[model samples]
Target: MFDVAPTELLLVAVVALLVIGPKDLPRAMHFVGKWVGKARGVARQFRSGMDTMIREAELAEMEKQWAAENERIMREHPPAPSLSAPEAESADGADMHDLPPLMVAQPDIRPEPVAAEAPVSEVEEPKTRGQGEHPL
Candidate 1:
């Protein structure tokens, strides 16, 4: 994270060894590593929380769009009327059988015959370029 090259890190280590001494250098390095690891863990947790919130927001928007489309479809094609109990059954408790029959008509289609082409006649010999024009 500090962008330290190998040579620069070596220089820093030598200085740290002279200042902090060899005995306490390992303990100080260990403590710093622990703090860096904790900072990374917190950053990872925050990133995951933001990702979860973004996903939930996207899902909520999709659900709203779906609901709007469903409502539009329902408005476009309303439900068919239901027959009442009295209308479905006759007075003597018999079922009614008076539904009208449906009629569908289809047009007849036929292919027409193709006409035969006439034979081509042979062409006569062509005249020279100067035959039909006057000299300039």
Candidate 2:
């Protein structure tokens, strides 16, 4: 599982035989294999524990940030000043029926000056040459 190919394993076995002698090499190899397995298991357990702790920390941080953001939003835009419908609806909203009388503007009914007229034409029709003569 260490990703060591067959050639690498053979090389390690040869080295172990040379270093520890053929008589003791088998015992050394057995102990070494067990130790590697234990090391891998410990590593996996540690990595999983770290992953769990990190996720928990991230969740807690997000919750805190959300709480802070909500508090800020509330401070920025407190509930609008409440008024009765008759007091709040102005004539500016044409669709509103319960508008307050005080919101209406006074109408200006003064007469405006009339617009000037352009000169009129007396002729009823204009004349044109016939195209049957020739192409110019």
How does each model score on lDDT?
0.89, 0.85
RMSD, one per candidate, in order = 9.3, 13.5
lDDT of 2: 0.85
Q: State how far residue 94 of model 1 sits from its true place (Å).
A: 14
| Prediction-by-prediction clash tally | 0, 0
After best superposition, candidate 1 residue 8: deviation in angstroms?
A: 4.1
CA shift at 80, candidate 2, in angstroms?
Answer: 7.0
* RMSD of candidate 2 to true structure, Å: 13.5
Residue 93, candidate 1: Cα error in Å is: 14
lDDT of 1 by residue, 11-113 (tens): 9889999999999999999998999999999999999999999999999999999999999999999988886655576587765666465577878888898
Clashes of 1: 0
Candidate no. 1 TM-score? 0.54
